[model samples]
Target: MERTLPKPKGIVIFGFLLPGILINLFIIVIPLILAIYFSLYKFTGGIMGDFVGLSNYAQLVKDGKFWNSFKNNLVITGLSIVGQLGFAFVLAIVLQSKWVKFREFHRTVIFLPVVLPAVVVGFVWTLMYNKDYGILNKLLSSIGLSSWIQPWLDDPGIVLYSVTAPIIWQFIGLYLIIFMSAIQNISSEIYEVAEIDGATGLRKAIYITLPMLADTIKVALMLCIAGNMKIFDNIFVMTGGGPGDSSTVMAQYAYNVSFGQFRLGYGSAVSIGMIILSLLLVLVIRRLMGGTNR
Candidate 1:
């Protein structure tokens, strides 16, 4: 006689996690594993069969172009984070003030850019920065500053910073919203007590408001760092990593290596490196911010 068997316990557990597991495997784990595998080979003429061991990584260490791209990324990330978060916090504070009129209208106007597509922002900024007959140049010319106008995307000196202008413009609104929410979460009682104690506006901000917003600052910093580290679309559309690769970040460099030059192995190595860097940065940021009880 045939006997029926009970369903395994492990199967039930697996079923519970199946959707998330499948998504992670397909979206993150599989691609990571494939990248590692590809990084061990040397591709030539559409062939990916030759294994090169750790040579790809070794070459990465000696690659000036990779370092240059990495430096550009660092600069861009630093500037974007500082400019975006600093001004966002200021704007949040200003909007929270009782004296500010039409707060909702101001918030809506600031947030409009956050909802725009990155490509659209890039194209719009490209037109604004165009040297010849572009709005920016025309405006400067009208103001008798035409000599100061230059090819924003073509100048190696200013290309990275110029492209970053659009990025900062697009994302500052999101951070502003984050800061505003955090500001609103602060209790009115605390502000009232501070005022009763003869605390000035600046003093209240320093002692009470900022201290309460510490956790929000940490979260905002993490998001800003991660987003800036992996920046691509804005740079791609605005500059195409051009003007002698002045604005090329690791993502753009990896794309160029993999698809543009068919150096799949090198590109995979770059991708893996980027992943490692991202993980390290996240861990470091978490540890630093974890000290705050909030």
Candidate 2:
């Protein structure tokens, strides 16, 4: 006699997931497919009646402006990730210190910037960096350091780094929160044991706390990398990729190609390039971080 098998529960599970699947396909998959399809054609003034094959990609390789924007993005990403993570880690350590009074107040103050809108942050920084009447120049002049003042967003040499400082400042609080949460999750008993063993404050922090926070560090680094890679709003609002393309990043480049220049096909190519670069960086981060730990 043949035995009858039970109906699999996968059908019910799939039915539960079907709506989400369809939504993702419509929202993400369809647009991605359209972008790839459009990347092979030439769009003139928002019209894409002509097919250009690989010419657009070839043009990107030879485009000096595109490469310059690409390099600017690299610099911005590098500075933002390093500066944000370093500052956040230091802030986390400070907040976790038992000797620090009013820890809650300090944390609240530090995290205020993270909740502020990006456009607002950009405008505030733009005013602060204004050459003549800006507070930064005023402070420098007050200290009799007048010779050090320069155009913050106008100089091509320092514009990219200057714009990055505001972006880093805005997000540092979020990363600090992440690190502090991770630090709190660590068992106090471990600290007690270390202290009983005559461990100094620095020794306990270096050997116990830092090592225990490795997983958190990895997560924070990944976040910083992804966030910096897609930086657009701050650069757009502050510099507008101006001062001779001094602070243009990848997203801005793509925006210029698609909307500014009305070359949707080439813009799609640039977007695809950015996507690929971001993916590669994510993979590199995973490898460097040992593929995540529980």
Candidate 3:
């Protein structure tokens, strides 16, 4: 038997949600509508030019640099799923173990980077990736791995990965915290029962913990996709899509086109493209993961 509570009156519910609804309308919905409207015209230099219709979008379909940036974004998203979510899950498991000491201290230390500004993180990593005075090269040289040291930010081949490293490092702690909270919500009796059944820690985690964390993992994946799709600040400060636009992502590409090149209309189209692609990716992920629709 279960008790049922009365649903709130419609007006009361609307009143309670009015502020948030208004804020989102002003901040997100309105701007998005404007971007879409601008995307259909030839807007340049703060002036509306010829009505381009779908020409900008047609151009976008054939834009090599835009596609390249899209590829980079996919790479970053994949790396984030593997690096941030994967590492965080492992670390969270370790922290939850009985033998791990000073768990709180470790949690706090890991999460410290999450509080720092993205620009600051980018600047710090940029200095570290310097070929000449950078500590990375120095450390490699000291350890007799001199041959392994190549330009982290200069080479187009590895610049994408190099920029991605900081993004992963900065956000791992956030996912770790999320995983920790999810793990805590699992029943202690489940672990106890598993132990009684002679299940090892690894086996228990695989069979029990993983199954229970499916929803959390789904949410984390969604967050990773959404966040990386619009990632700008870190890459902006670190590489500025340099080495000849080798490491650019969609957001940066959009920014460069809009403000940097004064192609506001095309930039808006790029932005709309980003939103569509992001939504598509999220849908694919949801479908693949057997989403909450059931």
Best by TM-score: 3
TM-score of 2: 0.89
Q: Which of candidates 1 and 3 is the stronger one according to lDDT? A: 3
Off by over 4 Å in 2: 1-23, 45-47
lDDT of candidate 3 vs native? 0.94
Worst 10 residues of 3 by lDDT: 285-294
Positional deviation of residue 175's Cα in model 2 after best superposition, in angstroms: 0.8
What are the runs in model 1 whose C-alpha is more than 4 Å off? Answer: 1-17, 44-47, 285-294
Candidate 3 stretches greater than 4 Å from native: 1-13
* Model 1 per-residue lDDT tens digits across residues 90-151: 88988999999999999999999999988889888988998876898899899999788889
Kindly list the per-residue Cα lDDT of model 2 for residues 1-294, writing each as its tens digit.
999987869989899999999999999999999888898988654456688888888888888887788788778878987889888888888778889999988888888999998899999999999998999989999999999898999998889888999988988889988989998999999999999999987798789878998888888888888888888998899999989788898899999889988888899989888888888988997897797677
- If scored against the real structure, what TM-score would every candidate get? 0.89, 0.89, 0.94
What lDDT would candidate 1 get against the real structure? Answer: 0.88
Q: Output candidate 2 Cα RMSD.
A: 4.6
Worst 10 residues of 2 by lDDT: 42-51
Measured with C-alpha atoms, the lDDT of residue 160 in candidate 2 is 88
